[model samples]
Target chain A: MTKRGRSIRVPVLARVEGEGALEIDIAGNRITRLDLRIYEPPRLFEKFLEGRSYLEVPDMVARICGICPVAYQMSAVAAIEDAFGFTPGPELRAWRRLLYCGEWIESHALHIHLLAAPDVLGFESVLDMAQAWPEVVERGLRLQALGNRILAVLGGRSVHPVSVRPGGFSRLPGPEALDPLQEACRAALETARDLVAWTASLDLPRETQDFPCVALRHPHEYPMNEGRIAATTGLEIPVSEFEAHFEEYQVPHSTALHSRLAGRSYLVGPLARLNLNRDRLPPPVAEALAATGIAFPSHNSHFSIVARAVEIFLALSEAVRILDDPPPAAPALARPLQPRAAEGFGCTEAPRGILYHRYRFDADGRVQAARITPPTSQNQARMEEDARLALERFGLDRPDEELRRYAERVIRNYDPCISCATHFLRLKVNRR
Target chain B: MTTIRIIGLGSPFGADRIGLLAARRLAREVRLPPGVEVIERDRPGLRLLEDFTGARAVLLLDALAGGIPGRVREVERSALLARAAPLSSHALGVAEALALAEALGRLPEAVGLLGVETGPAPGPEDVDPVWVQALCLRVPVALERLVPDRRVAGCGGRIRSRR
Candidate 1:
């Protein structure tokens, strides 16, 4: 007796951020081939940066992903500032960190609710989830709005904010502006804390696998705007040395590039960040996670929602802490930068994971060349690897719809901003 | 108290900006009712739902794909919902946002949408100024029809009530 070959094709994947497809081939109960096909046209952002003035890079990159515009802006400015040998003041740095916190909250909230929660809660869409869990959905929306408010205060608008510049912000909010934000964060803290427990209490699938986690690790704080790139495999490298350790390459099936750490697929984003930087969390956030009784350094990819929830708590707490001290009225921008010819690298912990940017500037301060490795691209390989392991563990013999749903759940777990990566999934399963 | 909120949703890219252009023009040219407000947003996504809060009626202006370029028409909520299969959460369009708003019970009593057809393959610079001006001239009339009682006072005899 021989097994018959069958193919299950999903033309488009829903409940994600961009257009993509997934194809899996199983042979005799084994996933012989899996491709997370990203059919969204390549955005060509890196190439667009070439020959543009360095001043425009921040705004240009910000257009890459609306959900994490601050990440792109921060990374671009960090790289450009490094090229110019400029360092912002403590106040400016704090503001940047605060801005990054806004992005994390907004991005994570959207993912946890609109994208991932429906899957976890066994709803077809967020609309369905909202009908059953209105309060939960409202909380997510409220938190998301708060994040946008913070971004609007700093960046001047929530979407593709225009206020960030190299060295410091182009504009700074008055001290009065911080008052409402501080109060809002304070109000949201309890909600964020509850979110952690809520996500933990969800009926999440429990499948742990051995995969190295990678994220930025700061000695004093949970990694956000600044840190060394560190991985669970004991690899630590400065942003400048990222190329020496991490590699990105194209696959035939996808338009987005897949990245590897030291020649192997590795995890990035919330789960990886939590696993690697659990110690760096604030005491309150750390205590909240501890209360969940789910230990960190968690190998379960499904726990990424929990990680996001915990980080939401961390972001709110950090927002409160940062806003507690009103920024003194000073020149919002540092001393103007002089055009220089140099190479610079910037790595910031985006909501998803470490976003790395490298730039070569001409003497005229034009971007001679540029490369941006977004978190989604970095996590692509790991997502595929996770999907294969997860589907195998899930039993490939299950009904095609069940297999497809399970695979989608595994991929959506990462909350891959397929738009950011030119990225992510329609599902096709071929069984033999 | 802005009871009627007209949100023009678009990006600066090509024909996609028709909504924004219409809204801005409407704000400048049309003397809207006391409780009416017009504003532009650039690809607000789920954030669009926020525009519905505290408003009794919400009218959304956007660029529609297919059909003759510059053809303006009223888009029903059902039609929007029917076409909205969001590929990504970040790319949640007007339809999904409205659906979510309805789901969360935040949808206003009266919701309406006006679309300016952008034709196929709209590029970064493909918007026609003639269509934009036409949208500006015709939208107020559509607004009158949609809201019924609201009278648009500006533009003298150029704008007439479809009623």
Candidate 2:
């Protein structure tokens, strides 16, 4: 009997955020080659930012990804503010945190319910999953809407929000808006807690692997909009020093650049954040997570779903806390800005992971150059590494369909925002 | 409380703005009944479900690719569901949103979609003003067809274009 080599190809990945495919080469149970191909055309947002006024940076960068526009805006504003040596007062900082909480809730809820759940629940998509578990779907949408409501109250609209600027928000919400949002957040706390328990209870795959976890870590709070870059590999640095430690380079198979921490693929996003900042969780969120009995510092990437659920709980609680002290009618904007020629860097924990931005501005405050590193691209190398290892552990002798499904589940665990990464999960297998 | 929602699902870019434009015109020109609310959304995605919830009925105005530009027609629920190919979670379209709503049993008892045809790769320049005027004129008649119990004021034959 002759052993024949066959290639299987999935033209487009489903349920992700952008265009990408996967190709695996196998020779007699040995995985020879694996490439997580990110084929989406590179959107040159950074290039477009050159020569734009500092004021336009936040809005322009927000157009990068619909799901996490606030992340872009937050990072952009933070960078620009840093450039001008402007530190927002306590009031502005609190509101910015609340706004970021809204984004975390929205993006995490959408991913946990719509994108990642179907794979674990043995369904083709969220629509099919909705047929079997309507209550679950409804809860997700409700929580997600609450998140969007928060964004609308602060940023003016959820998708590509507009109120963010270098100094502060364009207009602050009054008690009329804050009161209801606070009430909603308080009500949703219980729902978010249940979601954490529910996600933990799922019969998730137990394939754990060794990887370095990376995320922002703050001394007093769970990291979101501000923190020092920290990793499980005993690396800690300011956001300004990110480029010195992390390197992003292109590979032949992907349009998105692959990132490495000290030349090693590292993990980012929910799992990484949870691993690094579990000690910083608020008491209620900490208690809820403890109740799940899923220990933090988890290496299993599948636990990302539970991590997201936990963050949703944290985000809702944070929103409640912030809204309790609504913004004063004095003014939302900071003192008039005086721009100077300088360079600045900002790194925030985007829903997927750390989103970094660096800008070089001229004396007149126009951007001389810009660099943006979204989370998905940072996770690309790690995703490819995970796929190769996870597939081998799952056994290479399985049918192509099973292998493909397993491989996709691995990639989706990252919740890769392909549009953000130039990102992906079309599966192709070449077997001999 | 608004029992019927007329949502325009589109963005500010190019021909995609048609639904939003029409929605604005509807709110300004048409004298709708007390319970009918006209609103415009910029690519509401799954957020469209919120517009459907608690409403007795919903009418969605959107731009459809293919066919003659500015041609207005009814899009059936089945067709919308059939088009629910959610390629990416980020690109969740109206069809997927509607299907999810139906699946969760949250969709309104009465729902109708009115799509204005925008040819492939439509740009801002491709949006014809005359065609938009014609489309806007027929919207009230379409609304009457969708909800028979309500009559839209200023929908008479002698209606003049305010533009």
Candidate 3:
């Protein structure tokens, strides 16, 4: 029985790395409502973060999700160092960026080859992709494994890593350790460039949007670990005022709180980063963008897969370059922390997008309050709004599995980490 | 290496951690005798495989979600053995790690699985059910194969050989 205009939902979303659901309300021809509900059980990371020592913050936040633990670690340290009013030296900072690049290369490849491309090409999962496109999946796996290898080299444990501390690393990695990664990054970057070109030409639904894009910006380099916050609409603010402009509230359909700016929602992460930082992208990547003549910004979330691939290219190149100039030593971060009273905010560009962490420590050095805003939660509202717009523009003629597939794809694009979204994803209807 | 231990698997926080719950209930209610260790893990990952090696007998308690929901079923640990590369971040899932160990000629004398089926969308509170308790009886039921004696109390811990 071919059922038309019926919306579908998957209890667990795969590929983009966390758990989430897709809700589409289709009534005959016109689509009434569409929502990508992220119901990954709320761990309330930020609220739970209160009263923990600075040392424990990194460990506690890492458990927020398995997919992007490094993102959590980077953001936490940034916050910690900011709170203590210290900046990392050049060599140390380069290592941080290198680690982030590994994450980006690995994560982007996972999304491109395994998740997004499969959806476009009509495969159930990466498992299925392996049977059909063996080489592509193999390359993807090798790339992912290499990233894990990089993580294992630096972080101690690839998944939850114990290597990162306050000022820099517990110990600087040896040059020999960084050599193999450099070679892998070089190969992976070339592969990623080819992959991006292939994905950009795929027939996606024609849904260009006008999103209020936000991302980290650096005048000298592309934003990965450190940068000032900037938006497409010319709203630049210090990371400290993050909470002042943004608000998070829980929605009826989900436990996660959706975030918005001054009552209006904004988009973050890959698409936003690509649009806002197109200039900062490496020359080859910039040229790739130019060849497409994608003059303006991208609003189509489907193109997110393309953006991820391009990022993989940039990340691979950047990582190799950083590794080439190995730091003098893994800086000495073996500081015995003391109790302190202060407030600090830190923002880092995680693989998925902007990750922000803020903390207020008491005299005893215990965290009085801790707040984390990961990329997925920040993109929740934008995802739902994207769905509504897609329904209106694409014409909801979802027959049978098509509706479910479309919704799943939308959630997959943000790679909604419902686990992290648990801390955020506030939804409320505005009848303006 | 002379003694053997059986550990249950499942997570209490995860929606389908009931298998571990049942295994824990048995040991607590009926004290496990000497030379036999009963342990529980969220899931027997690669790390658990190392701990399980050289054991005479091992049993894993984990929930499997098939078409059947809330059905307590028992099978050999080998029955669930599906070999794939350890693609997960974990060193191994129970099935593959054990199979790999076996292929490397370090197989345990006896291995078993007590898979409890759970619902599509289970919650943290899905452990307490009449079916779950009834499923717990499978350990004793499975012990029937190992020990011929109908004696319910001792469940024959130090069996001589493969009965």
Highest TM-score among the candidates is held by which one?
A: 2
| lDDT scores of the candidates, listed in order | 0.80, 0.81, 0.67
Per-candidate TM-scores read: 0.91, 0.93, 0.71
- Between the candidate structures 1 and 3, which one is better when assessed by DockQ? 1
Pitting candidate 1 against candidate 2, the one with the higher TM-score is: 2
**Candidate 2 per-residue lDDT over residues B94-125, each given as its tens digit:** 98788888888888757778878887644344
Tens digits of lDDT, candidate 3, B62-163: 776564676777766557555444233222356654654454445575667777766664433445555456556666656544333433334323222212
For model 2, what is the alpha-carbon lDDT of residue A414?
90
Compute the DockQ of candidate 2. Answer: 0.37
Which is the winner by DockQ between candidate 1 and candidate 2? 2
What is each candidate's fraction of native interface contacts (fnat)? 0.36, 0.36, 0.00
As a whole number from 0 to 100, the lDDT of residue A229 in candidate 2 is 97
Off by over 4 Å in 3: A1-28, A40-43, A330-332, A337-339, A418-432, B1-163
lDDT string for model 1 (A89-198, tens) is: 77888888889999999989988887788888888777778899998788888999999999999889998788898877778888678888899899999999999999
**After TM-score superposition, what is the CA distance of residue A165 in candidate 3 from its true location, in Å?**
0.9
lDDT value, residue B30 of candidate 2? 67
- In Å, residue B122's CA in model 2 sits off its true spot by 3.1
